[model samples]
Target: MAEGRSIAERLSGAMERRDEAPNIALAEEIGASGDKAAVGELVELVRIGTARQRNDAMKVLYEIGARNPDLIGGYCPVFLEALGSRTNRQVWGAMQVLDSVAELRADEIAAELPRIIEAADRGSVIAKDRCTSLLTKLARSGYAEKAVPILVERLKTAAPNQFPTYAEQTASVVRPAEKPGLIETIRKRLETITQRAKRERMEKLLRKLNG
Candidate 1:
């Protein structure tokens, strides 16, 4: 006999169970839902369910966003609203979803950039990671006029552990016109980056950009 219900069935059931911990496989199951109306169910959960349910639902929605962002791209507002959840999980989790859908929904997100930055600053390191990444994604997708400077400013003050990873992605998005300003911004911070590991990473990135 089969050991359990189908993933979709289990996820559907899990969505209604507000008192219990969410099913770990819910995100994967949401992806397996063929990018359909089942997404609305996940959206509803994120909008009104308990905190654990909302967190899991956000995870499921972002899983869908990651696999086919167009599936959940229109729900950008839902994720944006959850940024204020009392729980940090929903807050940063929403940011992560926005990050996954940033390029796909850049027009919708462009106006919300400041709120995104504000949420990240008030939330956690995870929130900052995804928020900065979304800003870079928008800059890459053509909001460079308004987006690149914010990305550069964030890079200037990012924690040491972040310089290597986040800067790598941000570097790839710097347009030729923006490169000079970005390089100068990073170089100005180099004299202040006291961490050897982070300083080395910034130097390496600058070499590639300067070259």
Candidate 2:
């Protein structure tokens, strides 16, 4: 009460109150501030704060990365760890950031492809979607031939829920030399994808691939 401010006011810096922090506008302001330490602060918010805080912090991180990846790129490991978080927000949030910075650190990130594959199997659908995009990015980064077999295996064994998704994403990275094998893998899995909608999607993909 030194200055007669309310408790919420005095404690705002700690952002303990859910209503007090992770405000999108505030996050945007911090992102636009051009402060070099902003990434550190955002990382703290994501790691220690609530779900809303984590989501907003990542939004700002990607927004900053959009302008200059170097500002948010070096924290790739942090984002990769975030993938293991229980919250869907953090998982997909990390994916967005990783996707943004992957080009700059492909070799380092590509090394974690196994973890990435596990996340695709267990994380939220959007998380898996982002994972597929990252995998495709990795494939394009000179690992196409190696990644093709792993992705094909994923497609063959994917649960019905994720069959279409993995199929769709795998199709995008099937290089000309790899298309025949991927097509064969997809065909073998067609009977397993008994769900009509998903089965149709796979069929459409095969048609597109001329398989």
Candidate 3:
């Protein structure tokens, strides 16, 4: 089998050919081997691989998330942005990779909430769902409250298609856990609105008194 070489070597060879099987195998081996040596190669793959290859490399990074989440987490924003810009169906796979990376590297990406929301707001339906889900996760995980404004904006300006998906994600992805239906999400979103209104009202009252 010409494929025979240490897993790293085989993957290097495969990367030269842009071969899928070898890339997939290399991804698996890197995860299993926890080889720090492979990190540079993986990052390079992220830079140069075709859409499929880029997505595949991301999966490897996510798998490596199981071992060194910090390293894996560091790449989430880059991959997320890159994947979001893409229109191919393969972007779904990239979204999945982002999801896994977000889970593992929760702490690292926590500070990028606003950017995440902006990305979601600009994304396709599926990309928006994935980003919103991760945002909800980050919020629940105690990342920050910055995402609230974006969510509110989405609910406000949502089109027919966008609103339903946004509503579904609010139910399925934003909450602490998956809720059964849209009613619950609606209820929760209403609660969020009420809270924001209260805060705004208080600020208005404060301005009147200070004036």
Candidate 4:
């Protein structure tokens, strides 16, 4: 007595529903699919679907990446485009998805060099750090020269004043299990940078003025 269709069939029917809940359900089923057909559907979900639906699709795609390495590579552009909108939680989710995707599809997404560079240069520290880590992984995987320029540019653009605030905020939000040494580590790292290095240094001095 079959109470429901197989995951693939249910996913196919769900894809036609146009509702967010069905789209999300389809994403879940696709994760279960791990079959070749799920790749295109997952890509569309990330590209044009609702944010929740995109996150779900990204999760499935990341799971698929475990077996079909190229599944994530095919959507790097869409992932990067989503990341450009920093205010969206979906953007952050996309980044996490990209990290997994890059781990699996390292060679294929090498073409994302420019976006990777820009990401390291201008995004929030957490964002830049994640981009830096991905580029570092890419380097270790055999693109050292390609990743170096991006890393160097990122270091060059990072502001000294922003580092203190970044350290403080990071310390406050970091999990209690991590707070003991993480705050000190971030503070020490930020303190070593030259204040004259960036315009944001003035912000740090202003703090002294108010103090």
lDDT (CA) per prediction = 0.77, 0.72, 0.54, 0.54
lDDT of 2 by residue, 2-70 (tens): 245332222334455455343444434444665566568777777786666566677667666666676
lDDT of 4 by residue, 91-131 (tens): 55556556666655677556776765565455565555556
TM-score (all chains, Cα) for each model: 0.82, 0.71, 0.54, 0.51
Predicted candidate 1 versus true structure: per-residue lDDT over 1-211, tens digit per residue:
0235443345534557643234445555556656466688778878887665566667677767777777788888988898877789888889988999999899989999888888988888999998888988898888987887777777777876776676777788777777887788778877877888888888999999988
Q: Which scores higher on TM-score, 3 or 4?
A: 3
List residue ranges in candidate 2 displaced over 4 A: 1-35, 50-52, 63-70, 159-162, 192-201
Q: After superposition, how far is residue 17 of candidate 2 from its true place, in Å?
A: 10
- Return whichever of 2 and 3 wins on TM-score: 2
Best by lDDT: 1
Best by TM-score: 1
Estimate candidate 2's alpha-carbon lDDT, on a 0 to 1 scale: 0.72
Name the regions of candidate 1 deviating beyond 4 angstroms.
1-24
Q: After superposition, how far is residue 112 of candidate 1 from its true place, in Å?
A: 1.3
